[model samples]
Target: MAAASQRKPATLQFFLSAFVVLWLIAAAFPFIWTLWGSFKVELDFFSISDWTNAITGERTQTTHGSPFTDAGYYGAWIQEEFWRNVLNTTLVCIFVVATSLTIGTLGGYALSRSGYKYVFWLLIIALIFRAMPPITLVSGYLPVFFDWNVWGFLPTAIIVLVAINQPFTLWMLHSFFEGIPKELDESAKVDGCTQFQAFRQVIIPVMWPGVVTTGLFSFLLAYNDFAVTSMVLAEQNRTMVPAIAAFLGTTYTEGNVMFAVAAVVSATAPLFILVMFFQRQIVSGLTAGAVKG
Candidate 1:
């Protein structure tokens, strides 16, 4: 009986280990392939004649005199002026995250602290807005922006992204603020601190985990956004996402698809680094609101 029971446990462990190994390979394979292919020539990478040439960099050696080349990165970044798009993406993300957090922190704090009945309805309305596709909202913004003569600029896109992001931000921060004790606010008041002071000095410090988590999400949305950024901003103001799309348009016909691949790998690098650095904060923030004071 003991031997049979031990065998059953080992069988389960073997299946679980196999499942994990398979899952990891499935998730990692595409990026790994792309990274490997990025160093090879387009012909080799997409070889119809011989796919093994991609792994071996057979043609890359013929052209660049090496098994690998940085030609794609150089072409995309230096020749194609993709660094400008990177700058735009960085600026847009910074502005969107900062503005969204500022407004969301204040508004969420107010909603969480107030006992007003309308606050419930207000949150429901915000939820509805959050649920609506951002692309739908873009058409409405276009006419207004055209009339205001604010279309096709960085600030306009930043403002639009900030507005689109707000409802979710408010929802997240509201829940996070709710997890904080009301007694802290009361104590601040007892010490003659204003409501803003209580929030700025007291709640903000304790709410760092939730805020960091929310900000990461905001940064991601702004960074990864394509539809809104593309439509709102002009050619000169294009962000990384739109620029990659543009690369697809011109590079493929010019036999430079490897440039687009390299751009993708480059774009992915920041997000990878971000996750590696802030993964701990992200986990903490995600769980912070789960517990109540």
Candidate 2:
């Protein structure tokens, strides 16, 4: 009886595992297919025999076509549109990440250590900003930039993105700073370090995980942002997503493999780079060495 019961549960577990695996594959296919299809040229792409369509269930044949052109993998990262978007993305992310990380960390540390009456008021203000009034907020900045002839383009769009992300980063970093024990700072003080030295020598190193987390969020905010970027931004300075939107000028190929390829690679690149660089801190930092701390 015991053996039969155990076998029944094992059977259930096996089926459940198989279902989960298949579910994951289904969910991931669009993303994987987009990346693969991005490299394919036009002809090889729509052919029912193309492997590009084969795995994606768009077509049911395994008939091999030219490996890359059919697979939509070659021209993706090489194209002018893709590179343009990449440059725009790089500029925006640099501003967002740099400002958010620096300000968030400093503000977080201050909030953590201080009981100043003004700090209480600032925290409230930060919370309101994080609510993200995209339309209203953009409206506020539009006239100012427009008056200065800075609206709808390069430098101004970048600044608007930084403003959009600032509050969330500050909030995330503040919580991280609060989680750190104050005792460490006190111990550093007893050892003759000043506040700045203690933060530099002791707190900052320990809070690296949190810093990375905050930075990742900041990076993603700028990277994935579309609505505000689209609205606040004008014709010429479109980022990768909007830049791709430009190609949607009533062309059939716009819906074909090349466009998908560009979309996937361009959009995912910064996110991939950030995750690659901060893989350790992001994984470890959410909890931030809490066990040992």
Candidate 3:
């Protein structure tokens, strides 16, 4: 056996560490402020003691800003609206991921397999629509949705989200399908399988990493979205991010603190879980089409 020699970095490590620390500090302040501000009343924001708006018009609470610091932390975050927002965000994320992945996977497979001028145009149009700002799409589509009786509020949001997500996921998994050898499809057809069966039984299992990766992107895209949802959803129907924004209103109360804590809990939990769950497949999918195997 050969003895292993250790490699050492010179001055780069210290500078890199300092850079990361500064960046982290910069990032941490806003969340910390939000968290801390949640605890104290709106009047207590500036003064050492709690007072009504009449005593001190200084409304913004200092404690509400702190992400890491709170009086009761997660224990105090249980409120009706908080839980409702959590449920709303979760449902939207799941639906968006599932719908986008299914539609994208099937469409991607078709696009990759067939050669048609219309498909090219469609792809280009979808890409263009996706490239445009989400607000633009929301603004253009809102009046249409408003006029229609069947598609108001949440349904409208879902339709718009699915439209946005389809292009990105289709593009991702289309490249994955292209990377696969055509012989597999032919071989499956030569056996007892049809085209749809080959896709379901053969292609899907083989390229699952790509599918999973697409799902991950869709999940996060829907989960963290605020702007489009804000435009489409009313205040009562607000999702997680919008709910967090609602916390910073003129009247800061216990509900605001609860909302902040709920924000931290819900924000981190599912996101971390999904990443950890699909960690292996996501890594492979990200690198899959980069090089020939």
Candidate 4:
């Protein structure tokens, strides 16, 4: 009877593992297919004649003398100046993440430690702001930006992104701060440290994982934003997402779809690397926030 029970559990475990593997494959197949197609000419990648052409790269071989070619990348990055858009995106992300985290860390810490009843109301207000769609907020900012002649600028976009991202950071970091014991702060105060010194030297070190997790989230917001960036940024100041959209073109103009495909691959590769590098911290940070000591 014990052997039969063990056999049942073993079978269940095998099935569970198989299910996870299948799910991962299903989730990954689209990006994997797109990555493969990024290296081929449009005709081969999007072949209506034979769907197998995407896999075999028959036309790609004829056109480029190889099954793979870098022409799309060259066209997007060099000829069309996608590098400039990449640089703009980098600057926007840096500024947005930095600004959001700075404000969030400070504000969250204060609110978490405060003795005031008003803290609840303030957090509720922040939550309301955060819950609203970002696009709704963007429309309000447009008139002011145009009036200030600050429209279509990197700083303008950065400022807007920071505003959109700040409330989330504040909420996340506040929860993290709450997870930390107040005893640590008292211990630092007894050790001749000021409040700021305690926060900077002791509390922040412990809060590092939470900060990293929050920062990563803030980075993603600014990195992946399409609506705000597209509307606020001029053509010359466009970021990767908007630039990639431009590569797709509209009814009025022709677009290089392969360039967009190649650019998509280029844009997505870094995010995977970042998550891999920070995976441990992310998991631990989330775990810490969810569980109270």
Q: What is the TM-score of each candidate against the true structure?
A: 0.93, 0.75, 0.73, 0.90
lDDT of 1 by residue, 70-167 (tens): 99999989989899999999999999999999999999999999999999999989989988888888888899989989889999999999998998
Looking at candidate 3, the ten consecutive residues that score lowest on lDDT are 53-62
For model 4, residues 87-168, the per-residue Cα lDDT tens digits are 9999999999999998889999989988799998998898899889988888998999999899999999999999999888
Residue-level error in angstroms, candidate 2, position 70: 9.1
> Pick by TM-score: which candidate is best?
1
Q: Candidate 2 — which pairs collide?
A: 38-72, 38-261, 39-72, 39-73, 39-74, 40-72, 40-73
The whole-model C-alpha lDDT of candidate 4 against the native structure comes to 0.88
Q: Which stretches of candidate 3 lie over 4 Å from their true place?
A: 1-9, 20-77, 115-119, 150-152, 250-258, 261-265, 275-293
Which of the numbered candidates is closest to the native, going by highest lDDT? Answer: 1
Q: Considering TM-score, where higher is better, how would the candidates rank from best to worst?
A: 1, 4, 2, 3
Model 2: residues >4 Å from true position, as ranges?
A: 1-8, 43-65, 70-80, 116-125, 187-194, 250-257, 273-293
Q: Which ten residues in a row have the lowest lDDT in candidate 2?
A: 57-66
- Candidate 3's TM-score reads 0.73
Candidate 4 clashing pairs, residues 3+ apart or interchain:
none
Name the weakest run of 10 consecutive residues (lDDT summed) in model 1.
Answer: 284-293
What lDDT score goes with residue 49 in model 1?
92
